[model samples]
Target: MLGDIWNATLKGMNDLAGSVGEGAREKSLALIEDWLEIFPQLAEYGLEITSFSMGLAISPSLNVELLGKHEDWSDEAIAKRLADHKGEHSITTVLSTIRTAYRLQKKTQAPLRDPLILKIVVRISPEVRVVLGQPILDD
Candidate 1:
């Protein structure tokens, strides 16, 4: 599963280079590589790191975006979407990149003031949420 994520993410990063400048492209790739290095810890929390990859171009650091897809906003939505959906436009590359922009805010740590990056706790699967001790609620 993680391998798929890594491959997909790597391809996504490579493809991203064409849409951005040379320096911005390299920064984006480095940031994704950094995130992938810590993927186990991030994955343990049950939230698939999402949209903030491009934010890395502007600032080499970022919290992931849980609202990478509108329906991915909550675990319930994630579960439902997983169970019944197929071929979502945003889900095409394991996540969406359109939501990312150079102007997006950034900080030293996660759970930023940005609404898109919020909801990660609830966005996680129920079991992982329990382990993480985050009381599940509507996202």
Candidate 2:
């Protein structure tokens, strides 16, 4: 039973990952960059940015509801550490933050429509810490 659950969970994660593809990733980044481009002077402020992988891993919708709180991290290094740790408290904290951001950005609308990626992001996100608002690279 335990093994079966694990397998199911992994499959779900894959499904979620597949939905938020390269196109969505690029589109999301472009949207954010356009939003931020207005403030060229604020470039030094290290706005924590998150990738599609991390966002999907932590399916922000469930996380926000679970934690009931959110806070931003200062840097990618700290975000990565929070994501890697397995402690319940740490996971909850990270998930809460991601969920809050997810809601704030209205990211759920699209992902929810795609069951596969939505499943992956929601199931795997508790273990991932995502920084928001990173600069998008020109492709």
Candidate 3:
């Protein structure tokens, strides 16, 4: 089940890269690689990326939603711990790299562009279940 989910996620990411255009495909793939590298670190904090969306407009941006589960901890506590740990780990650096890659892509792409934005939203949940055959949860 886990392997299937992983494979689907990779396919989705590859589709996103292809949709972004040839010029930016390499950068998009790199960003995906960077994200994969940080997954284990995030798991240590009981956090997992639930979903992500990318938009191109005046500002090319990627929005990532993370769901965290810490049964004994309050949402605020989880958020605080993740924030502190993020600074101590490669999260901040990787985010910066992603933003830089988007910015570079923006400069080379056609049409007008603004600064790239990487928005991350973290939410605390008591439990997270990966429903079989579902790529993403509705709730």
List TM-score per model, in order: 0.23, 0.20, 0.31
**Regions more than 4 Å wrong, model 1:** 1-20, 46-139
Give per-residue CA lDDT, model 3, range 31-121, as digits (tens). 4444556667655655566677665532234456555432423445445655665754346553344434435545777443332222352
Per-residue alpha-carbon lDDT of model 1 for 1-139, expressed as tens digits?
9999999999999878655666665665554554444344334434455544333334243434442223223545444543442554223222222123212322223333322332221111110111111335634
lDDT of each prediction vs. the true structure? 0.37, 0.38, 0.47
Which structure is stronger by lDDT: 2 or 3? 3
How accurate locally is residue 108 in candidate 1, as Cα lDDT from 0 to 100? 29
For candidate 2, the per-residue lDDT at 47 reads 31
Q: Hey, what RMSD does candidate 3 come out at?
A: 18.9
TM-score of 3: 0.31
The alpha-carbon deviation from the true structure for residue 104 of candidate 2, after best TM-score superposition, in angstroms, is 31
